[model samples]
Target: MYRERPAGFARAVLWTSTTAAGAAPTRVLPDGCLDLLWSSRGGLLVAGPDRTAYLSGGGPAERWVGLRLPPGTGPAVFGVPAVELRDRRVPLGDLWPARDVARLAERAEAVPAAVLAEVAVARLRAAGGPDPLGARVAAALSAGAGVAATAAETGLDPRALHRRCRHLFGYGPKTLARILRMRRALALARADTPLAEVAARCGFADQAHLTRDVRDLAGVPPTALLPPRPV
Candidate 1:
């Protein structure tokens, strides 16, 4: 089964799958652009604007790779978990370079599941400890906690926090905080709260602030993205 939720910014989740689906993978680009790429259970290999291929796992082994992505001209795929792929905008070939999978197959198997799991755990630990900046930032944003207060709570200097955020999340601390705040607003919007109420509760300056942030992150107006309240 695969379920994806937009977690503010470009982050998302692809649930566990049992088979390798030859489908195009969908990703939110660095500039917040969204696109689909060819992927399988083995890993998610995608080429960036720089023409570099990146692979991340869709199964037990969460391995990632950075190399030249292969090209393919096919329909863009979406929605399926493992076995099937659906086409969307942009032909698959225009987006990806042709890859000789057989020749590069060995590199794909470089990291075992156990090793990957360990690495993930270790990385999580490090992220929470030495790299706790992202965690601290995420926590603060989730709780609507202020950046200054979060820095104090995490025992990190504000400047240090900023540095860590840039290194880990690709954005500065304030931007991440705003993104988190916007994420909360999206949740509240989906819950059918009034725009003003969502703005206030999410720490936005006002409804306009809420609208701007929501539109920036979700690619749609707040009203359009949010579902109607249950009658």
Candidate 2:
């Protein structure tokens, strides 16, 4: 069974099985975004930025895991019983053991799903509100605006900004900046804008920079990912 929780900024979907013994293994792939996954029974095996998955019926305790991807890899495989998860911005991996997640999933059957969603939203709000440095950095990156200037605006030393970002966001400031720029470029490319224009508008140094970033994060060239526009 699948349960959805409202995260406010980003929604979360939870999956669980009634008969844990009958649960099949699952595979989760990269979806070019960041995710925080928790397992109740088992642990998730993450194979680098490109591949990370869970083994269903593996766990029953609450273990939280966070993953951030920079793109550029095909779907990862999870070895177990047959299960597949797919999404453009979010991919699913093998269903492994997760005690906490399983408990939450089971709880959904008792309480209203919306109530659990509200709880998730509250948690996300608490975590996000307590941290300002990461948000400031993320905002600047998402805008494709000045990094140095934004760091200055936050009243943090350039190096300090880097340190805080890595601590709070689990990635370097520069890497986040590149991901944000790449996302902006993707938006433009999807709009049918020319490649050079997309690169320029998204603050990439050039088309090659855009290409490299896309390849690194999405495991495919920008052209390959962008759908052809109707003439």
Candidate 3:
């Protein structure tokens, strides 16, 4: 089973998942976000932003908890540039002191979700909150703005904007825009909108363009990503 709720700080999400024995692997599609994870078996870890889908494995029945930090808020909470952790999962100790992380891991063994939220809220406060630029850039791109237009709207030249995005989102603005657009297309499809209309509404050149883009990022076609229709 899987469920999620807003974390009440920094636009993050608190999610939990539990798998039965021999459960199938989960395909986690890219969405330009980072996660702070706690496992019944693995303790505390961090999940970095991915350029493509990540296939998460399952084994014996176990519980997992995570705080999903929105794009651009990760560096503030994790104390490193997003690019440094891209496409990787590492022990929280690798970034913070082992002694401190170990103590927190012990607490997480009892109430994992609360520990994740406490760590994020504290770090974010110490850092004076997430940078406003992240929200602005993400909003413009999600609203169908082109990369050049987003750059102008954010008041940065193309080169400067790209550099900032790399540090903040672990990729350039163009890649982030592509990921966000793919997410938008999938959401529209889930509403039972026709694929062609989804493609047009999401800024794709056509339905074919949408298919190729989704395949490149998700390693599957749009139809495969969507849930099955009713009988």
lDDT of 2 by residue, 67-186 (tens): 332221112112211112222122222343466445555554455334344444554455443344545666776776566887888898888877666544444567666666776787
Candidate RMSDs in Å, in order, are 12.1, 10.5, 0.9
lDDT of 1 by residue, 1-231 (tens): 343343222132222333344443322212211233223333433322211122333334332322211111101111111111211223333333436333233333553233223332343344342333444566665787777887798788988866655444444556666666665777777777888999988888999988777666555567865665568
Ranking by lDDT: 3, 2, 1
* TM, every model: 0.52, 0.57, 0.98
Local error of candidate 1 at 130, Å? 7.6
Looking at model 3, residue 23 earns an lDDT score of 89
**Using alpha carbons, what is the TM-score of model 2?**
0.57
Name model 3 segments beyond 4 Å from true.
none
lDDT of each: 0.44, 0.49, 0.93
lDDT of 3: 0.93
The CA lDDT at 29 in model 1 is 19
Q: What's model 2's overall lDDT? A: 0.49
Q: What is the lDDT of residue 8 in candidate 2?
A: 38
Deviation in Å, model 2, residue 161 alpha carbon: 1.0
Better of 1 and 3 by TM-score: 3
